[model samples]
Target: MSFTCSDCGKGFTRSSSLQRHQSVHTGERPFTCSVCGKGFTRSSHLQAHQSIHTGQKPFTCSYCGKGFTGSTDLLAHQSVHTGEKPFSCSDCGKGFSRSFSLQRHQRVHTGERPFTCSMCGKGFTRSGSLQTHLRFHTGEWPFTCSDCGKRFTRSSDLLAHQLVHTGKMLFSCSDCGKGFTRSFSLQRHQSVHTGEKPFTCSVCGKGFARSSHLQTHQSVHTGGKLFTRSDCGKGFTGSTDLLTHKRVHTGETV
Candidate 1:
């Protein structure tokens, strides 16, 4: 004999299971976790939720010795070691180990940023990334270095900055072999080798390797003198020209 749900016409082997299933339709969750106050329909579901707060993972992977809260999660972790990418993106054909990961990656192609910041109205692909970005607006630096007491918003940024204290430069330019603390600096160095001048002046249509150089060059067309001589009250367009003019009074060799 099977217990049936009148609301959804679903049959259950036990009356208790049918009663638990009915809670899904009624949105009634009796079992609640004390730690997080999260409600669940079944006691077993509430037990699993408690494990997240307790940091208790009972299931262990046989291959890599990785721990998970459930046997299904343990099986999922094992797929990474096996190099099994079962889930694939329909738009770009990119493979992922998990179906949820693939669904998240698909949002990149769809331009669907579900996670949004309430303060700035900025959208992010992941909720965790948005949470980290919120630290910038709140001026919260949680991660701190024990060595210098330097603070950072994320743990990854703190780890990278710690390499500076050790005098370690992992990123290097291929052309000049000059090392840099960050990959963004190494990429900018590589542009010099390729002779790539991305920044340009709008008024004169002049190109420059950097935005700062372009900004300085734009001052030439502004018809305003920024540098002034204190002795003669003479004005110059650039600081270098004013410094050269002051050499007449200082008696310095040019």
Candidate 2:
């Protein structure tokens, strides 16, 4: 007998197939992996899951030594070497390595917020993205480094921190052949070669590649007009500012 999905008019020959199909609707994954204890609804998923256990990044690039778990991931990683973006969105001409990334990128245009935070009123287009943001408020550093006791809020942060000890530079430039600790740092480091200042301040005509630098530049306005005391050379704005400023004179810096 065939198992019929009463909810969607879809039918499957096997009960196991029907059960696995239903999980997609309910967003439920009951099948658990023994190695990582990660759960998946499909057996093929469990097969693909095993690669992470062996650290088998067999998918190697022709141009770079960077390896990836899946072939598609290798293709994604290759785009960095050639700057060749094949997956272009028809909606925005915004390219991505995978179709899912293009779909996610489309959300920036449509302003769709599918994932909502239960603890707060905030929303996000992606569940993983919302998970990263929720970590900020909880002060929970779930990702830990095996080398060091340092903890980070995001997996990417932990990965970057690990580079300090591992000395493995995956992303490198073809022009200069210089490697960087993190991808963002490499992107910034490339600006020196290309002379690109993407981040700009609205307050002043001055521009910077990093937002933190722009923020510090904005403080220049508030940084000035600060009243400082003589001899100790303390600075403040108002009476309350002066009072709190007294804490430094009271040997708080020590």
TM-score of each predicted structure versus truth: 0.41, 0.53
Q: What does candidate 2's lDDT look like per residue over 1-254, in tens digits?
A: 99987656679999988887676445466666676455576766666666766778777899968777777778887887878887787876867777778877676556566666565444566655556656644556766789867777665677787888988896797679998767768877888888877556667778786543554465576564233454476654332354466566676441
Show where candidate 2 strays beyond 4 Å.
Answer: 1-53, 81-83, 137-139, 167-180, 184-254
Which whole-number lDDT from 0 to 100 does residue 36 have in model 2? 40
The list of candidate 1 runs beyond 4 A from truth reads: 1-57, 68-73, 145-254
Give per-model CA RMSD: 16.0, 10.7
Question: What is the Cα-based lDDT of residue 220 in candidate 1?
Answer: 85
**In candidate 1, what are the lDDT values of residues 191-214, reduced to their tens digit?**
889887766666878887754365
State how far residue 122 of model 1 sits from its true place (Å). 2.2
Return model 2's CA RMSD, one decimal. Answer: 10.7
Count of clashing pairs, candidate 2:
0
